[model samples]
Target: QLLDIARKYPDFPIVLETVRECLQDVYDVPALTELMRRVAQRRLRVVEVETATPSPFAASLLFGYVGAFMYEGDSPLAERRAAALALDTVLLSELLGRVELRELLDPAVIASTSAQLQHLTEERAARDAEAVADLLRMLGPLTEAEIAARATTDAIGGWLEGLRAAKRALPVTYAGQTWWAAVEDIGLLRDGVGAPVPVGVPAAFTESVDDPLGDLIGRYARTHGPFTTTEMAARFGLGLRVTADVLGRMAVDGRLVRGEFIDDLPGDQWCDAEVLRILRRRSLAALRAQVEPVSTAAYGRFLSSWQHVGSSDSTGIDGLAAVIGQLAGVLIPASALESLVLGQRVRDYQPSMLDELLASGEVMWSGAGQIGGSDGWVALHLAETAPLTLPAPAEIEFTDTHRAIMETLGHGGAYFFRQLTEQASESELKTALWELIWAGWITGDTFAPVRAMLSGPRRSGAPAHRQRQRPPRLSRYSVARPHSRAADPMVSGRWSALPAAEPDSTVRAHFQAELLLNRHGVLTKGAAAAEGVPGGFATLYKVLSAFEDAGRCQRGYFVESLGGAQFAAASTVDRLRSYLDGVDPQRPEYHAVVLAATDPANPYGAALAWPDRAGDADTHRPGRKAGALVALVDGRLVWFLERGGKTLLSFTSDAETQRAAAAALADLVSAGRLPSLLVERINGVAVLDPGVDAERAAVQEALTGAGFARTPRGLRLR
Candidate 1:
């Protein structure tokens, strides 16, 4: 059977032997001895036994028994040898006792015993099975028994069974009810059995009373290595009072090296090799992570004590110093140190506590007194700590004109010329110079000459023939004369070439009409006729002159009837139109527009009228008569129809139009699709849209829909 079992599992070890006694007998000594010998041989161990009767030769032969007869007799040396050999036998026996022998015995009895054992085990497992069944029933109907079996076989099942047995056997009663009943009522059965109650004193009290002197000694030696009591106490968490006694005992026992108490060691003082190696290998990041959570006050106390023990002489200490110095520099700049001191009633620092640090030159004074000589003033060099640099100027993209100016400046260094000319024409030079000055590229003081040349008074009283003739040139004899002074020719020649002024009654009448129009806003035909103004001549000539001098007007006019400079006019019209387009009246700019519109007879409206007002009287007339002005009443609806397919007014220009427009605007505002009127701007004019109230209503509705509450002014999201 053993061979079959070993063959079945080829990796398993097997042993076999023959015995003189009947194999089936339970207590056959010879057979047992043979079996034990085979067991020892297979396991590679020695076995020994002592004989009652002794013969030297027989004993030697007995000791030579290869399988079942190994033995020793009581001789003085033999007893010692027997004891030595028996130790292995005893150890093997103890090991073999731990292994169960039932599987190796008769199968019928084994099967019967196992069945009985399984019955008991099943009885123990039944409560667990019930719990699993209950849990499965709660979840859903079982899909299969095999799946349910897995839950029953889990550690929780074992725990549940144990708990059930414990509760049944030991029913602990508290407060007039069984503890088990309370546990079930509270659903504590889900987690399994409660811990067993401890007898005698509590473990916490016992552990506290038991001195951990050995552990403390070991930890102290490891952390403070080769240190005396004073140094050890200062460095470690152990209090100084008790540390000296422990250290003295440890020194007497030769566990520590006794030494003279020199608290401050030199920089090169040796420590335990292991400690030095650990310090060398410790990473900065790891140390920072460990120490960062330690409060600054606690760290300061530790550092103060550590300095006293001469631990600050290492490179790690130097690194820490540098870190602290840098931190102080940063924090001092950000924090108001004087204010903190004045505000808080902090404890005064102890002089004795800081004595070691001061004496060892680890601490230094950093206040104004440290500066010395000039009132001991200490000034921080901000530049040394944090430097600032100005941002470089952004490069600007240049146009062709800008590039030309740059090139001209580069060549000319600085120009003194009143005008820059592309060509030598006086008009071109004046135009270019004016453009440059306007664009801020060139500057000059003398604009009078250019201005006069462009628009100036003409000379009068010269005959037509004389005006037409060119000025005379200087004689060669006069130029060749040694000291003959001549009138400044350039000035004389320019003055001579000036054109004579024309004095006509027609011109005078045109000027007079223009002056009147400039002074007053009226241009009545009756007044003109009363002044004997020819029907077409004065008006046509005046209009032409006005057109010529249009560029000189401070407040320029645009003929909206002629669309050349329509932007400014269009903007003004659009601003007024937008305001009338249901703009919020509460907005400052919108209110201004509303006030302007309310006047009805404002002169500014007439000024804004188109020049060809007679042709399209309804469209171009000012005030309510103008089509644009009337459109303002329903402009919101009109704009909506024009801008998008949506209709602001359902009823087209009827009694319902206003109501429909208001409803649509209110809906839009509610939908959050429209901005508040107070903040809206149109055509450089800020106007609140009338839809703002509607928009607020819409926002409130949305917020309420999204599970919020609305107050009078706004909605609260929460």
Candidate 2:
């Protein structure tokens, strides 16, 4: 019905009735002010007076009289009074002559006394023109006739010509133009005449006209609103044409009113279309301006408020509450309260719990219309935040070889074996097994049984025989082999020269026995049988005697013991010569060598020390052929040489090997890996033993010269 009424009477005023409680709704201030201005410019009979108050001072300044007293109470009382006096005494009297109080007192006086005000307005305009003329003359040469003529034609043109002429005759030009001079100077032009006399003036100066208070009031009311022309003219003191122009603009915007006019009064009728349109536009603009700034300010506040809330220390509900409070206080529109609270709650919990909250519709935004329980909220359910479980230890994969070995070991129990079934090389297999033991997967003692088994059974009980065994006899064919020549007549009275032919019978036998012991770990039956007989046959006894003399076999309680197969006396001597070839003479190990001699008491030979010790608990004469064995120990080089029984033999160690050994010995001393013993050289042979003081002193002096210090245990290489 309201729409139908509004459409039916578009030009009619809109009147909405509401209860007294709603009457206090204040319209937008800027909207109302713009509407009032528009209405007044339309020259309408719009009267925006203080209907509720008796005095015009109570009226809104935008719509009512702009009198001095109207602005009172806004400024100091004295200032207000001074302004009012100036307006009345100086401005009002000069602009409107002989103004009577009675003329201003009547409401109808504006309509009737408008002509008198108009005449006074013309007189005042004339006086102003005269004053402008006087001002122009003072500045330079200016004529009244020229001004009057220009005023009717092109006043600005005439004025400009006059100004140009004055400037040509004077040193300085006036900064500003007089009233009539301005018009002439701006619009006047001259025709092509004998002296270039003025032809026509521009329309701006020629068409200029005087305006009266009534005309101004009428124009103001028509253009801005429905107001009396007397009011506009009194406010602005404008001429008729200027007021009409203002009226034209207001009328175009539909802000004018039609009716009787009054002085210093607004139009009684207003253009509903223009005022409402302006009010709506201004209201929207104001609302947007106000809302945007508030939103921006609120956003800044929200950020600042919660800046410290999410730091490392804050946790749980307290942190959530702090953030929620900050958001609520800083966001726009009080309606955001629930949204902020719910959002903050959801954000505070762990991500894994989000789905539950979302499914239950525990969080939401409030702006949505017709919101159901969960309709307006955002879903926050998320995946679990816990770390994933890893695969089982048993399922871990290993190499085929490792798998095979582990499988062989069996589950839950252990077994001892000589070999492991693995694809790894021998070295790798050893390493892997060691690693397993270190890792506690296998027992360290497990190797004991396996090592024992691989090494063969231990011997027990005494043998049936009591005498030492004789070496084997060589066949006629073996005796004739050239390779055995070196062993012929083995270790006779003295070291024999190299033979030109195959070895003799005794040499062949000794060589055969050595080969048997090295390869098969057993002596020939003949050799064994020969040892059993106490007094051998001559040939058997001679062969056995030669073997024994050569240190190739020894008399044990049960049987003969073979010596190491790597060296023959000749080869040993050759190795000793090689060691000496490049050995550095300065190193202690260079002068050190090891000597092995047949034990006169035991079946096997023992390592020998020079100048044998007596009464030592660990000392024993392991060999009888002490003079036959001499060697140089040079790192991996082992050199051997033979000397006849009772002959003096020299043995030396490689210098490099001795240095390395000394350094290692020093470390051993520091680590307590070695016993307190001296490392010394006796007769050019390095000896590591607890011995005579002279030997110790000699070794200490050598070590000190080789960058070593004497320690309690031995010589230490620094």
Q: Please, what is the whole-model Cα lDDT of each candidate in the order they appear?
A: 0.30, 0.31
Which stretches of candidate 1 lie above 4 Å from their native place?
A: 1-204, 207-237, 240-411, 417-430, 434-687, 693-718
lDDT of 2 by residue, 1-718 (tens): 2243235434534322211112343344454444434443453442333355543433555333553344334332222333332343223435864332222122332332332322223342323344445434332223344334323333444444454454321111121222223333321211100112233434553332343222323332323322444444334434545555665565454444332223444443222233323333433343333222112112212221223311444345454434332222111211112222232233344422322332333321111111222111111111121001100112233566556556666543333332456366744654454334322233221112222322344444357695457558675454454442221111111110111122254543443344323321223333233222222234344554455444544322111122222122222222222222232445333332222232111112221123333432332222233223322233221222222211222222333444443443344235332223243333333334455455334434444554555555444343
TM-score of 1: 0.15
Give the alpha carbon lDDT tens digit for every residue of 1-718 in model 1.
3333234444423332232122355365555555544554556323344559855767766645631222122112222332333333224435753222112222333233333322223442334545544433232112223223434353453544454454421223222233222122222211112223323323332223123443344433543323445554433345656666665565455454332212344221122324322322332222222222222222222222222211233233333333223222111200112111101111222223222332333432122111111111111111122111111112344545444444555554344332222434433443443344333233222212222332233343478776656437665444455543333211111100001122454564555454333311222232233223444335634554453333212112222222222112122222222222122433312110011111111222222231122232232223311111111122221111111111111112332333333344333335333322121221112123344444333432332443434333333222
TM-score of each: 0.15, 0.15
Best by TM-score: 2
Model 1 score (lDDT): 0.30
Off by over 4 Å in 2: 1-611, 619-692, 712-714
